[model samples]
Target chain A: MLRKLFKFHGGVKPQTNKTESTTQPIAQVPLPDRLVIPLHQAVGGHPRPLVAPGDKVFKGQRIGGADGSLSSAVHASTSGIVHDVVPALMPHTSGLTTLSVIIEPDGEDRWGELDKVNYRRTPPDELRDFLRDAGVVGLGGAVFPSYAKLKPGKEGRLKTLVINGAECEPFITCDDLLMRERAADMLKGIVAMRHMLQAEEVLIGIEDNKPEAVAAVQAAIAASGQSGIEAVAIPTRYPAGGAKQLIRVLTGIEVPHGRRSTDFGVQCFNVGTAYSIYEALELGRPLISRVVTVAGNVDRPRNYEVLIGTPMDHVVRQSGARPDSDRYIMGGPMMGVRLPAFGVPVVKATNCILVGSPALFPPPPPEMPCIRCGECAKACPADLAPFEMYWFSRSKNFGKAQEYHLFDCIECGCCSFVCPSHIPLVDYFRFSKSEIWARERDKEASDAARDRFEFKNFRQEREKQEKAEKLAAKAAATREKVAAEGQAGTTSAAAETPDVAAKPAAPSAEDTKRALIAAAMEKARQQKAQVAPKNTEQLSTETQADIAAIEARRAAAATPPTPDA
Target chain B: MLTALLVMTAVALVLGALLGYASLKFKVEGDPLVEKIDAILPQTQCGQCGFPGCRPYATAIASGEADINQCPPGGEEGIRKLADLLGREFKSLSEEHGVEKPKSVAVIDENTCIGCTLCIQACPVDAIVGAAKQLHTVVAGECTGCELCVAPCPVDCIAMEPIVDTLDTWKWRYPVIQIKQAA
Candidate 1:
């Protein structure tokens, strides 16, 4: 029911190309003979293997345990024999391999014992642990741990829990179809999350483009007769599914930078995530499988609730992907990743797999030089000066590039899409960010080295100072004894200038003390001077301001040349 | 007063004319060479070329300061781009710009690192962590993988390992060609 306001900054209206697949219902694909399950499927630390090689694992059994707080556990998608625990090629931009558990599935899909919990009466902590065990994470492409995201802060005050039904990415309508068909299950999941967060209200934001899905969710809400839960339809926009963007569109409150939406009295979960959560908590099912959209250039483009760790080739073949059509993408065209080959497995984050020929969606245009047309700048949603970033990026002046608010860029690919030159603007930004991080890493290492050197120097100085103090004290005692002897001799034979004899010894201790103080002062000065450059954090801050000033000057200086029109 | 004003105006006009003429006469040929040089740079925004982006880097290359081998994203194509920009012969992607490894972030093997924090301090982007004698970790989002940490690691725990390529990291490589075939 929220009215959309505020014109969003630079974006291109790419062809939705979704109708080709949205009409078709999800179809099942035959399981693969071999499944290569990468340990780090979701966005966190890689899961460590709980079962060694040669272990007989049942379908949906926990084979890989959670490795870190940010990671999730992995379950066997099919009953299989663990063939090997070794490095396997994963589907990523890096094209590198990591540790994976390869399972050679037995003919039968034998089920494992399920661990269902009664959420109505169960404690939230126990439910959280249960969800973790189920490997329930955000199925909205980010693959973030759902339990970790639902955990409330120390203040324990959570306001609105926003269910993100806004599947803005084009050609990926699994969420849309799910809501239309499985609205009841999706709603049940929402209630479970509501209890988990102790949130006051539950707001479901569905994009108006999916009118049927919205109507279905509304009917479901009405049937449940749920209080404090309402479905609000938002306008269709690219990246409208982003937590911050969706929050602003629905609630009119911007999620501040580097802060979670939860900080602003709001929490977000995808429609798919809700369903997954429902299955995990109610059905006692672990996230051993997911819904995938196999669309584009295939004879039949449809959604499938396939078992996780299924190979791409098998899924595509089942979906009727033509053999002549080899180009395959893992997500939506706007921001989806392209796999090098079809051998990669379908991981948790993968929602849409496109197998297309050149005719349906043509390859990107040949890139030309950025002519400073300012179209990219117009397209940047972050209000950054992309042309200048282009300039600085071209120059390898990362410090200045950052000064221009490079980090603020969400890498939405709008600039690249809108560029007259077909410039890969996002690529430049990614490179700069990577370079900045690398430099930061290097500086940290050097600082650590310097600290060790300084600590050693400090220790050495302290040791010298202690040694000199001990020697001086010993000399003083010797002098005191000599004085006593001289006094006794004077009584006996009227001898000696005792004061003159002790004068040389007295100044030595005082001189040594003065020398130690000088050394300490020099050390302090060195430390201060050396520490100045090491404070690289300030470099980002100062450069940011300088970039702002440069942008201001550019705005004032630039007057558009009279067009020939 | 009228005659004096007339004389002043005449002299000013003559001086202005002379100055304008001299300005043009002394002006060195402002070069279009930089643009041509920039055209040769591998347009991949990977800054291994040491320049922020391709154009400014092209300018430096035109001036004959930057090495040709620095671009990894451009790989051979970028070297060719740089070569085209400089009107120089193309060469292989420099091994030092780092091999055409799939893009990866540096991960610190925390256990082996001596907490010397050398990698942390050496990071120009401040991506590494751990205090004196404490374990240091890389903020993955902030790491650039310039290989600046590799040399600084006293214990050699910091590795320039490529991020395991997942469907997430994969991007459609520039297609060999773009032509519309009627479906």
Candidate 2:
């Protein structure tokens, strides 16, 4: 059946330098000397490393345990001895390190026992947990754990399952190659996901640019005898592979900004993710390796099935990267981040390492002022006023940027690609978005601190009130006993006034407690001298002088007592 | 003329009673400006501002008894916000209170701790936990980097350490671009 597709608001078509990488089939890269797999490959909680240094681990053995329900577990890519679990550089623009398990391969790729589950008989929740522990995540560069998104829709099942084969990014053909070669396995996984989600229909949206992948998926669906699944070809556009954009095109449902597609009875997954699910459930294998494309500034561009944590330079060397190749980008040229160095590993989010040279990807021209050209707004795929948002962002007016729905920009680079003045509009939007998030986090922390401080005050006040009540009760009993002895009203009232009722006179208990505490503290201080920390005790002479000065100030502060202060 | 004077007196009496009743019915307690100022404070309870807690400092500021630059934990950004909020001129944070520093949390050297609950009692947010004569530890999440526990520890086991930025906590920096503006 011919499928009519919907168009998203605005998109730019960059040069699709994809044919060079798709010439050869996906090849397996030989094992490197060491692998450095980061524990945080997905979007949620960082997984806790389970394997320590000097531990023997097998291929498919879990190396990192899921930190929480939202997190995905990590597996050993191959049988090896763990060298260490330490912080190593990650493939991020910040060049920050994360806790990773470094392994030295023993040349034996031994697999651990795998538990295959029959999806038809298994519960959906159990299947999701299995997927989490198996490290099945979106392979279209997002790397969001698939288990979290597998949650049942509001109506108990999804209305449509949109499989994104729209690999619209230039020079990234890992998804296309996978669809062309392993379409049958992908269909099996997609069918299994359908069973788990209880979906009514599935639409495989591949860009018309990859006709082979589209035809292959259509043939696979026909061969598998799947009734509800259909392969639909879509117009080739940059960022059409974005989950929201693909969903909008396939089902004509524009998921509201910042909301989940599942909320609207639709769920989307990358085609490679479906293949991994099929391998995990049917073959009893865990996610350890994926097909990554090594393209740009290389003599021979090709796709390789590389183990997670394999260094990027190792793959680049195989692809014959020229000596002039200066940098590597981890994804499409439009949306990928520039890798700080080559030693960073191929991670779950890595789909392509577009090696860059001054010749291949020239530096952008110096920026000129925006002339109210409206070109950026015309190319924004998310339908945002990019120039206005950029203006507000550059001025550090994050509130105004947010008012323009800055979060929906998706950092797609369409605006920058189309800007005649060579403005990096998306970078401004990213800055504003990060600033907003940072402010929100700061506000949350301050709010929490305020709550804790108020609670502490309330507790102290209540304790004081309770102490006064107890003392008053004791004094009342004494008054009654004296009255019984016929020494009534006036004397007892005077005694009570001097003791229980007056705030100043009631500190007898406080005085005794303080005395006891002071004695105990003196003893602790003496004992503390023996174990005093070197850092705090042997302070530099400057710090010592500062401390002495502070001490004198503190002594002066004691002269005139201020309430609570 | 006598009847007109009686009618005017009665009207005045009724209006006076209504005004008195309205005052009694809707009497507001506590200064709301103090609450707004308190909300702007960092809630560190560090006493670096010469007040016991954020609320007292806020009260002082609201009553014109304290300057707006007394809080160091809130830093210059916070001062700017306060200035904008109160229509006051922005002032550099007063060094008398303390110099602004990066956010940090207290870490207790468990080996050196002598089980005196001084730090616990000194904690304004009660973020420190331990029984007297037992080891005391700070609940790092709730410690608020107030530094109040560091000074009062009889054993001097507490030290303030700045939080490290990891890949997860790392953020995209402001983009650097040189623009040639002719307008």
Best of the candidates, TM-score: 2
Off by over 4 Å in 1: A1-7, A153-155, A460-565, B1-183
lDDT of 2 by residue, B1-183 (tens): 999999999999999999999999999997789889888898887766767778888999888899999898999988998898789999999975667889999999999999999888777788999998999999887888877666567777899899888654567777767654322
lDDT of 2 by residue, A1-565 (tens): 6777899988999999999999999999999999999999998899998988999999999999888758999999999999999999999888988999999999998998888999888888888889999999999988999998887687889899999999999999999999999999999999999988889999999999999999999999999998999999999988899999999899899998888888898999999999999999999898999999999999999999999999999988899999999999999899998988999999999999999999999988878889879998888888999999989998999998889999878899999999988888888887788778878877887888888888987887787778778777777777778788987488645566535364864454335434443443344345456666655777989998998999988997878976765
DockQ of each: 0.04, 0.36
- C-alpha-based local distance difference test score of model 2: 0.88
Error of 1 at A119 (Å): 2.6
For the record, the alpha-carbon RMSD of candidate 2 to the native fold, in angstroms, is: 7.2
Clashes, model 1: 64
lDDT of 2 at A64: 93
lDDT of each: 0.74, 0.88
Give the least accurate 10-residue stretch of model 1 chain A, judged by summed lDDT. A489-498
The global Cα lDDT (0 to 1) of model 1 is: 0.74
Task: Kindly give the number of clashing pairs for every candidate.
Answer: 64, 0
Interface RMSD of 2: 6.4
Per-prediction interface RMSD in Å: 15.1, 6.4
